[model samples]
Target: MHPAAQQAISTLLAEGKTPSVATVKAKLTEPLPMPVIIAALASYKNNPEAITHTAQQSQPAPAKPQSQLDRIEAKLDKLLALLEEKQ
Candidate 1:
């Protein structure tokens, strides 16, 4: 079972809600195969502890710096619009 699926199920359980395909799928950050989700649900039913494992902490992605080319492109676009307006 995918770790994300397990975490979703665990979260649902913690929230006092039963985990279903729709609910589990909705809780996932990324999409998983239907069969994989189904199998994970079944596995959870068989052993709830499997889904109760500690969730791993994920770090947020760093912000990307704006490139010089992007700034130049924006300036060119503005210049083009102004030129078009005067035409």
Candidate 2:
């Protein structure tokens, strides 16, 4: 099961709502394919602990690297300089 779907299932279980295609879809931040959701539901049914396990195993989104941000800032600075030169 996709981590997102697993997380959604865990959340739904915690919320005391049954996890179904529509219900899970509603709980998710982004829409997932029906097949993936269905598979997740099957996985959950086969092993209820998987949801809890997945939730615990899930990692938070990593922050964007500072170097990448700096590169973008440098590009924007160059663009501004070019625009000023034209003016």
Candidate 3:
């Protein structure tokens, strides 16, 4: 299982939220592999308390280095440069 997926499950359990495969899938920013999700779900099922315990030990996620706007602007600039080069 991906670390992020494990962390998400851990956090959800800690928050007193009951997570399903669908709910965990919905919470992720990127698509995680099916096997990873299944494994995570199985881990939760086998040991619910483990997830909550790990959540308490884990550190908070770090802030993103670039915001959405910054990424969009960079992509637009590259596109404009390509267009200008073609002319």
Q: Please provide, for model 2 over 1-87, each residue's C-alpha lDDT reduced to its tens digit, 9 standing for 90 to 100.
A: 787788778879989998988888877745688999999899999999877876777755766534546878999999999999999
**Please, what are the lDDT tens digits per residue for candidate 3 over residues 26-68?**
6665569878888989988998877767766776678775555
By TM-score, how accurate is candidate 3?
Answer: 0.62
User: What is candidate 3's local distance difference test score?
Assistant: 0.77
Q: What is the C-alpha lDDT of each candidate?
A: 0.79, 0.81, 0.77
TM-score of each: 0.59, 0.63, 0.62
The top-ranked prediction according to lDDT is 2
Task: List candidate 3 segments past 4 Å from native.
Answer: 61-87
Error of 3 at 84 (Å): 9.8
lDDT of 1 by residue, 1-87 (tens): 787688678778889999999999988755699998999999988987655554434322545644557778999999999999999
Cα TM-score of candidate 2: 0.63
Sort by TM-score, top down from the best: 2, 3, 1
